[model samples]
Target: MAEHRRLFFALWPDEALRQQIAAISATADWPRGARRVPAAHLHLTLVFLGDVPAERVDAVRSVAASLRVAPFELSLAGCGHFPRAEVGWLGCVDAPPALFALNTGLRQRLRTQGFALRGESFRPHVTLARGLREPPVLPDYPPLHWPVSEYVLVESRRGRAPAYTVIGAWSLAPVSD
Candidate 1:
């Protein structure tokens, strides 16, 4: 049997933004079946490339390395629910062109190289909680500022606590303030 690894590409948050998300989650009137995501595991997935042979990791890394993205500022606007998915999420109400462009480039490369990607249209969100019986009423939240400087390829491993690993990362070109 061949060994394969489950992977996805995502934007991991800095500590400052992580804390703000944690604060927001702490105050929610969570539904009985819902479980809040751990702050440490918070991330916005760009592309979910299910299982791949272990040897194909470099191909994934090459796609990441070829991106020419610049840093962009994103503000966490509000929360919403995916009814079928039973997921409550925080999302940027505004989808900046930079974020769209980056997603396009990265996914295009993956597709050109024959990798299968999820068919859903890209929606920028960080899942806040899961297993909800129904959508909870999300109250207004102070916007959390996100500084997008890099994207990483992460491996999802099942374990106690957060089960994710940063296999590789590439920085977006820095723009001077």
Candidate 2:
């Protein structure tokens, strides 16, 4: 039997912008056992491909390489909690059509390559914290915006807390005839 790893596609935030978000998250009164995402690991997940065989890594890389979307601007607008009980997060205000299209295209490509995916529609947002005891009331913060230039395929390791490792990255450049 081979080792199984959790994989996903995501867009990491720029260093400066990530730092700014971290500063804001620090001010929030998070719940117990809630782990705030580290500044280095802040990202918007595009697809969650859970528990794949190691042998399939190359195939996944190829699927990512074949993507045809250019970089676009993404902005963080507000915060909210999932289930209104656990999982606090900052929400994306205006996710452009290109962002949805890009995710949809990637899902189609991955499906063609025999990768089973979660059947949920893509909702682009960055997770700020998890395991909250109470719902969060978002503070008044100026919008945080940044250009998304690349998407990465990451392997997530399960443990006391999940840790992510980047396996491959695809740059998004505009198509030319």
Candidate 3:
């Protein structure tokens, strides 16, 4: 039997944009127990598939590669904590329609291929930090602009500090000027 891989779909920013987004973490005072996510690990998850068997990886890859979306812009702004989940996240003030369609397309294909995702609602956010003891007052900040061109399938390997590796990426159609 093939080993299962913890997998998810994410919108990863280019290094420069990633740095811009990561800087937002420094501006806030998190609640006790908060652990800020490292700069390299910052990404907005499109859909999280907890685990998939080794044999099914190709099927997942095919589904990802088949998706069709035009490139769109993403605006990350504002930071807040989910009091219950203790996750402090940064998110877009205006999530574009293309983002929603891309998400739905991936979910539909995955479901047909026998992968069931855990969550019912899809809220677009990049988790900045976690383990918040209490929700702090959120702050308003200028939007961090990131152009969404492609999304990747990431594998999370367990270790002292879990490592996330991009296994595959699919590009969206480029918009004509």
Candidate 4:
């Protein structure tokens, strides 16, 4: 049997940002049995490439490396819940154009490389809590600004806690004024 790994591309936050995100998550009034994502594992997934065969990892990395998008700032404000998924999240209310462009272009590139992907619209968000029976009434939060500079490929390992291993990273091009 071919070895397969669960993979995804995401924007990994720095320690300072991670701490800030964790702090905000701490303040949320989560219902009982809700599992808050650990600060170390907090990230905004750009693309989910589920269960890729070991030999195909290189192709996935190459697709990310070919990205020529520029860095952009993302402001995550407010909270929302996916009723069907029962997932609580923080998201960008007014996202910048570059963010969408980056996702669209990246997905296109990956698809062109013979990777199968779901045709779902991209909603920029960070999962804060999961396994909620009902949506918790969340307080209004000030926008958290994130200066996104790079995107990375990550491997998800199943365990008691959420564990993610960064496989590779590609820095976005610096903006030229």
- TM-scores, all candidates, are 0.93, 0.92, 0.93, 0.94
Model 2 scores a C-alpha lDDT of 0.83
Q: What lDDT does each candidate get?
A: 0.87, 0.83, 0.87, 0.86
lDDT of 4: 0.86
> 1-177, model 3: which lDDT tens digit per residue?
668999999999899988876666777777777888899899999999888998899999999988888999988887777778789888787899999988999999999999988877888989888888676545566888888989999998887797999999999995456
Stretches > 4 Å off in candidate 2: none
Off by over 4 Å in 4: 174-177
All candidates: CA RMSD in angstroms?
2.4, 1.7, 2.2, 1.8
Q: Tens-digit lDDT track for model 2 on 60-111? A: 8888888888778988888887765377788888897778977898889989
Per-model clash counts, in order, read 0, 0, 0, 0
> For residues 1-177, what per-residue lDDT tens digits would candidate 4 score against the true structure?
999999999989899988988888898899888888888989998889899999999999899887788899999888888777778888886888888877887899989999899757898899888887777556766788899889899999886765899989999995566
Superposed by TM-score, candidate 4 places the C-alpha of residue 100 at a distance from the truth, in angstroms, of 0.9
Q: Which candidate would rank higher by TM-score, 1 or 2?
A: 1
Question: Which whole-number lDDT from 0 to 100 does residue 83 have in model 1?
Answer: 87
Off by over 4 Å in 1: 159-162, 174-177
